[model samples]
Target: MQVIRNGFLSLLALGALTLEGHAQAVVAALECDFPAASTDDWNMAASTLQYYIDTARGWRVDEDSFSFDGTANIVVDGKDHVASLSITVSRQSGRANKTLRSEGRSLTVSGECRKMEASGRKF
Candidate 1:
């Protein structure tokens, strides 16, 4: 009976992992700098933003993001006439590019990403 119980528990754990996308995910933060875009610039003063990425779906930038398929890469597009911010990051290489526009001025920043502990290099 004990052996049977152990087998059942193992099966349950395996099922849970399977349902959760093989337990794959990536957690990281993006840090960037922006020069003065005039005083009327957007208030995105945060130097770093945390990301919670779903390898099969998409990632959230500090809990907000434009939805897109992020299996191979991360792509986001947030725009309007007054302001726009777009991001593209390769999941395999961890290279990132971001563009910010406000009040008719725009800036693009590119850099490598640092994955958090246990986050691994690939999503």
Candidate 2:
């Protein structure tokens, strides 16, 4: 009788732990930052970022664009515009698909156009 009771309690404990884990997985957020100079540059960066996000099998983007109120900081330096944009990307396993939140700055040079590098991790 004691053996049966112990087994039942162990099963109950295991079930509770499983439930807790599931709950935790259901409600969690991941955050990161991608730095850029201005809106046009950010637009280019966002395109590449979108490409990766779209290609990933299990990942989904939560928001589509960056709100100036939430994720953008702009500064003008002589002939250059410096911008920092914050973006959030999220994915759900089963029902809800995915989303991407993007924000950044654009650079426009008056004279000759030059090649520039955009840097950041997609995931």
Candidate 3:
């Protein structure tokens, strides 16, 4: 009887440890910065830009022209009265490339994942 009781206690302890490990898996915000635009037409659009990738939830940003989830490759094709920007995130590898055009001038930027943090609760 004592041996059976000890075995049950061991199983319960193992379950608790597993739960604790799973709780630590979480997603944090992601940010990327691009080069300065050569022309003033894209100044306003490039100033207030932010991007985030949540491993569980998906990708999010403040711009309306950009829409992406965490799973597939990201693509951004946006155009306004004064400027336009196109971006693509590679699926086969972890890399991103972007191009911004305004007033007959263009700027390009490339990005890669530096580090990912797990701060928030898991979904």
Best by TM-score: 1
User: Per-residue lDDT for 1-123 in model 3, tens only?
Assistant: 011101111211011123555643333333344333334333322321233343333344332222252221212244323435455544334355656554576655565432233553221
| Candidate 2: residue 60 lDDT (0-100) | 36
Error of 3 at 18 (Å): 32
- Each prediction's whole-model lDDT (CA): 0.38, 0.24, 0.36
Q: Is candidate 2 or candidate 3 better by TM-score?
A: 3
Going through the candidates in order, what is the number of backbone clashes in each? 0, 13, 0
Q: Which ten residues in a row have the lowest lDDT in candidate 3?
A: 1-10
lDDT of 1 by residue, 1-123 (tens): 011101111211111145656773333433222222223343333244334344332444332332222222211244424335565666555566656554566555554554544543343
Question: By lDDT, is 1 or 2 better?
Answer: 1
lDDT of 3 at 97: 62
Worst 10 residues of 2 by lDDT: 1-10
lDDT of 2 by residue, 1-116 (tens): 01110111121111112454553112222222222223433322211111122212223344442111122223234233324332223322111111223333333211111111
Q: Which one wins on lDDT?
A: 1
Error of 3 at 8 (Å): 51
